[model samples]
Every structure is written in structure tokens, then in C-alpha cells.
Target: MSTHPTTARPMDGTARAAELTARTAAGAAELTRRTGTAPCLATVLVGEDPASVTYVRMKVRRCELNGIRSRQVVLPAGTTTDRLVEVVSGLSADPEVHGILLQHPVGAHIDERAAFEAIAPGKDVDGVTMHSFAAMGFGLPGFVSCTPGGIMRLLDAYGVDPAGRHAVVVGRSAILGRPAGMLLLARDATVTYCHSRTVDLPARVAEADIVVAAVGRPELIRGEWIKPGAVVVDAGYNPGNVGDVDFAGAAARASLITPVPGGVGPMTVAVLLEQTVRAAAVQLGEDPAALGL
Candidate 1:
């Protein structure tokens, strides 16, 4: 809990993401040159949640910039789960759609899981399907959840190996916290998951070499709880650009910490684009690495 200032370096996810995006763009271009069609991503939006709409718009813009085609499908908020699933299934079966992204929080009554499961595993670029989860958990060759995958890329870019380290992830949501812990474990890190039922969460965070704040609470992980020199990655993006970790406090103790707005957020979209290109390359009978992905 030392308040003294420390020389903590910020994990520059923006720069890292830019580098990845550049590589993916080249891959997409190369794939397009080889094949007659460009890599296409189908984005399905149910209802017009302002935030979700903005997110999808940003993703579509990125696809345009990266030489990937984007198809937008907007449905009414009151759309039935069965109908949504049908739409997703149609997209999954489409040969032109190499990647599928169904914006989350479709609606309260919508069976989000059912819609996600409807996506073909090969086209689940967002990695929301159970097949993607299993692949990530097993370290198999498949798409990773965007945010968790971005976090891993950040760790690698910063030369922070997870092997043999104690990693504590504060949150247990299936997509963010749980998948993050599984990804860390796949890399040989001893992982712990903290949730609403966890007791003395700070104590757990204090013992970790790596701490991931993904509970979607503003500044929930106090700086005092961060172990000295630990790498802190705040994956949660709450209102007003605030993250789950107290960035200022954690920065004082962490050797490396990710910022709220420019850190995990940019990387998530970058991973999605990269995976989309990879999916297209695979579906087009080309090797992803061949295109520099």
C-alpha cells in the first residue's frame, strides 16, 4: 500500500494494436489478391443501444480501413430469440461471410447464448461461442476472445511471460474473467478467479504477479492491493472511460499497467480484425502466417 511514486510504464495498447492492424491489413490484401473475394465480416445488431451501435460502427470503419468488407444487419429490439438465431445461422452458412460479430447485450429477453451458438465456429471472430471457449481453454488453433486475447498480446509485447506466475483475475464473467483466467492457465500461470462471493479480494490480488481487473466496476481494485512490480491490466471499461482498477494507485505499485481508454479497448478491435483475416485466409485455403498474420 505504499503511496510513494514508482517508475511504472504504461502498456501502450494503442501502438501495439496499430502494429497488429497493419499486419492484418496486409494479410487481408494479400488474401484478396489470391482469392477473388475479400475477407468479409458480418455484423449483426439487435436493437439500437447507442453504445452498441457506436461500437459496431467503429468496427465497420476499421474493416473498411483494413481492406475487409463489412455487412451490417440491424434488427428490431423486440425481435424474437428464434428469429435472431435464424439470422445468425444464415450468416454462418454464407460462404461470403468469413467472420461474424453479433453485438453483445442484444436485449434482455433475447437468448444471447443461443444466437452466439448459432454462429459457425469458423466465423465466430468475436469468440463468443462455446466452441471458441473450448478452443481457447485447450490452447487449440482457434479465435480467442477479443479482450482476453488482446490482454495476452499486450503481455507479450511488454515481454511479460505468464509462465510460472501467480495471476489473479478479479471477475468471473464467462467472456471476460473466466476466459482470461483460462488463457493465463494455458500459458502455465497459476490462476485464481475472484467474484462477488470471494472473501478478502485484496489479499488475493496482493499475492499475484499479474492482476487483471475485469469486474466492470469503477476503481474496484485499489492501488494498495496491487503487489509491488506486479503487472496490472484493467480490462473493464465502465462509464466515463473508467476501468475496474484504480489506475493511479495501481500505477504507483505496478511495473506495467494498462490505461482505461487506450489500453484494452483498442486491442479488442485489433484482435477481431486480425482474426477475421485469419478466418478468411483459412477458408480461402491459404495459410495465415503466409500473409504475415
Candidate 2:
């Protein structure tokens, strides 16, 4: 390794994710040993959106790597809300399934919240369900939405303290943006959420001590818009895997920044695997191994 210190802190999600997967592997092994059933996540994808397909595949592949089992269920674009709910509800009732992660953008016609509600709260590892949302807002124990959960892990691994900081989260989607803001709030950060309709997006982003780019628009946040030495997190993934922030520009201005492909992406899968293992152990009537803490 080069001895020269990096002027800009590269939040190394690459290395941190390696460590998380290692632990998840062990957890999977222990759960399998005790229950004779591997921990499994049932992924539900509605429609044939290419990005949604890629995301689901990525999650399943990661599950395999971490020694967890994943089951995929695909529905048609024309699938109705009730039909989607039926599939999700069935999966929730399946004892073999420990967790359910339903991908978003389930077509405009489908009632997204209703589909999310079909999964039992305990099996809602993705935290898309109302129960998970309420729990997160209340700072109670529950499965966190995976992306936000991943973001939290990244923050922890980077030693980025959010206490008393201003955290600006762009996007208000249920999974990533909204929950991410709530998480920061729970950590004592004053949080603000901005979206396309926000009057002054640039001003809001520039004000953040911690800027999370969850809005899907590519490079919508400019370099000059960034606060010098602020921490920048690009949670957005557009075509060609580009993130929401202009990486090159943001990286130069940010004291710390997370890269697109390696940063939040890896953590999302890691959180899913972690939650899957935990859900499995709980179903087995055993506490998730927390190093005996």
C-alpha cells in the first residue's frame, strides 16, 4: 500500500463489505447447522424493467456468495395489485422462506404499499412494508430497508459521525431516501429531504454536512454545488451504473465520498444477507449470534 495519505478520504466500502460478507457467511453456516435449512430470501419482481432484473440478480448472486439461499419469483408487467399481493402473502407464510425483498417500480397500476404489506412484518427484511417504516420512524427494533441499512453500515465503517450534523437526503422513495433520512434523524442529525419539485435543490445539497445522493437523475448534483470537505454518498444508480452525483467533481470537493459501484451497492446486498440470516435464526427459535452480546 502507498504510504502517502489520501487528501480525500475514500470511504472503502470495498473492504468493509468484504468483512461483512465474511461474518454473514459464518452466520449462514451456524443457522444451517442448527436448523438443517439454509437461510433463504424470496425476491419478488414485478414487470420486466431491465434495472429491476439486474438488481434482483445481483442480490441473489450475493446471497449465493454469502452461503445463503435465494428464491426468485417474477410477475408480468400487467399483474394486478391483488395478484402481486397474493404471491407475496404466500411467500410470507412459507416457513422455508426467512425474508422477502420486493423490488420497487412494480408498474404504475399496482398499489406499491399494498404489495409491501402482503409480506409479514418479520419477513419484511427489505423494510418496504408499513410496519418496518413505522418501526424505523419510532427508532424501534425491526428490519431496516436494505439500501438505507447498507448506507448506515457504510457510515459506521467509515467512522462518519452524524451526531448534530446536517444531513440532506435527495429523493423520498420509501426504500432508500425516506428511510435514510429517518436513520440520520435517529442518529441526531438534522435531516432535510429534497426531490425534483424542490425549489432550490442545489442550495439544499450545499447546506448538508452529509450529502446523500439517492435521486436517480445522473449527475444532477454539480461540483460547485457541493460543500467543500463535506461527506458525499452517491446512492443513485442510473444507466451504465452511474451515480447521482458527478463522481469526479464531488470526489475532488468532498472530504469523503463513496464510489458508485463499490460503495452503497455492496452494502445493500450485505444488509440483505445479514437480515436474511437473522430472520432465519429467529424462525429457528435461536437468537442471531451477536458475538454473545
- True-structure RMSD, every candidate: 1.7, 3.3
What TM-score would every model get versus the actual structure? Answer: 0.98, 0.93
Q: In terms of TM-score, how similar is model 2 to the real structure?
A: 0.93
Worst 10 contiguous positions by lDDT, candidate 2: 1-10
TM-score of 1: 0.98
Q: Write down the lDDT that model 2 would get.
A: 0.86
Q: Model 2, 122-192: lDDT tens per residue?
A: 89888888889989999999999988988888888878889998999999988889999999999999999
Model 1: runs farther than 4 Å from truth?
1-5
- Candidate 2 lDDT at 49 equals 94
Per-residue C-alpha lDDT of model 1 across residues 1-293, encoded as one tens digit per residue: 23344757999999999999999999899999999789999999999899999999999999999999999999999999999999999999999999999999889999899999999999989998999999988999888999999999999999999999999999988788999999999999999999889999989999989999999889999999988889999998999989999988889889999998999999999999999999999999999989998
- lDDT at residue 196 of model 2 (Cα atoms): 84
